[model samples]
Target: MKARVHVMLKDGVLDPQGQAVAHALGTLGFQGVGEVRQGKVIDLDLAATDRATAEAQVREMCEKLLANTVIERYDIEIG
Candidate 1:
């Protein structure tokens, strides 16, 4: 099975990297750009055969180490 996790900063969180990217885009002639937020995608290959099991394992991984629960939220997809 394949599990994909998307991790992103929660609202009201400061994102300096995202701000820098927006500024760089404007400087590079990209106009009409609004607020930019950055996130990460993690793709994992799991040994579990059941979709539900894979998802549960991945969710556990996120809660334990992949995401900082204090400032970040995550979504999981299994295939």
Candidate 2:
């Protein structure tokens, strides 16, 4: 089984890196950009036999170590 995890800032969290990138892009002549958010994607290959088990493990991984739940949100997809 395979699991994909996406970790991103919460809706109201301020992302300094994303802001910097957006600012730089604006300086480079990019226009009409409202906002920018940055996130991370992690791919994992697991030995679990079913999607349910894989999903559970992925969630555990995210909660335990992959993401900081205080300021970030994570979603897991299994295949």
Q: Evaluated with TM-score, which candidate comes out highest?
A: 1
Write down the lDDT that model 2 would get. 0.92
Query: What is the C-alpha local distance difference test score of each model?
Result: 0.95, 0.92
Q: For model 2, how does the per-residue alpha-carbon lDDT over 1-79 read when each residue is reduced to its tens digit?
A: 9888999999999999889989999999999998999899999999999988888888999999999999999999888
Error of 2 at 45 (Å): 1.0
Lowest summed lDDT over 10 consecutive residues: which window, candidate 1? 51-60
Off by over 4 Å in 1: none
lDDT of predicted model 1 = 0.95
TM-score for each predicted model, relative to the true structure? 0.97, 0.94
